[model samples]
Target: MARNQLLNITIWTALLAPVVYIGVMIVRIQNGEWDLLGPEPGRAVTQFLGTWALNSLLLTLTLSPLKRSPLSINLISYRRRMGLFAFTYMLLHLLAYMTMMLGWQWQDLNDEVVKRPYMVVGVFALLLTIPLAITSTRNWQRRLGRRWKKLHYSVYLVAALSMVHILLQVRSSWTEFVVYSSVLSLLLIERLLNRQKTA
Candidate 1:
């Protein structure tokens, strides 16, 4: 009963997070709360959304390892929710970038793409998630059969590309980069070890 309650809480939290965050940010911005958002409030919003998206992806990766742990709580059912949330966050991040950064300027986007290759990497990562999110249903899972697992393996690539996209940006500190890379590395190492054990 407790586990089920926890799951419900978690799922509801995930569902409401993005909506609540955007709503709060919009309200704060309307009230002239510039201090919290920095000088470039638009950029700050874009970064915040992108960070949450990456966070969701990392959480998705953690599920498999958690299931293998002694204290596992059977969170596998929520994996699809996490993945869909990640994609939704990424979509919002892209929209934020378009509206906030580019101001919906296609020419500017083209120039920015040429100058900032990291944006391309981020776009690719977002693109990769689309198919995964679409085929997350049980019907598609059954239809894909053995190929489903293989297709989903692209998620690791998305994570790697996302990390690279983040590192490519001119951040004031590399601390977040180090933390993301460390977690991803640990997850990958755990997966490799598990594969070896099973082999």
Candidate 2:
């Protein structure tokens, strides 16, 4: 197959895999294969979604640095699509938390934002991701140029806030905290190294 075809296949697989996994989980729960009403269901969902979001974000951040290596240009083509997928999953994660846990109550949002520092950070991160997602379009990229880059740099902030969000939520889970912190460190290091090389 051609390089473009291979790249297309990879991008499609990356985008669809999470949907398929989440769909299967939902189907299993509906079929009584797994109980969604368990004591830890909410925590389970939160951790799962949060972890997936972080992983996708890391993959998105890796694209440019990887491209600067001897890797093929086709690899870089996956960046935008992956970034959009990251945002899609992040939005789903936020919506699921709000609808399933908070019952879509605006008052509950107000309370959470004020009472919970982690929730506040998560909400802020979600807000930051909005413009990046909106401007992920080719047309917007062409129109905005340099400004688009400055806007998308907010992804780093989003990633930092997201880590803090997860860290605070998983209070006692030191293992998870370590794992996520390590990954975020590596991603940031890759970004720094790439910048130094370009400079």
Q: Highest TM-score: which candidate? A: 1
What residue pairs are clashing in model 1? none
- Measured on C-alpha atoms, candidate 2 has an lDDT of 0.79
Model 1 lDDT per residue over 121-146, tens place = 99999999999999999999999999
Cα-based TM-score, every candidate: 0.93, 0.85
Against the true structure, candidate 1 reaches a TM-score of 0.93
Model 2 spans > 4 angstroms off: 1-3, 31-38, 70-74
Q: What is the lDDT of residue 152 in candidate 2?
A: 89
Tens-digit lDDT track for model 2 on 95-153?
77886678789877778877778987887898889899889988999999999888988
TM-score of candidate 2 on Cα atoms, chains taken together: 0.85
Question: Judged by lDDT, which candidate is best?
Answer: 1
lDDT of 1 at 153: 95
Q: Rate the local accuracy (lDDT) of all candidates.
A: 0.91, 0.79
Q: Candidate 1, which segments miss by more than 4 Å at Cα?
A: 1-3, 31-35
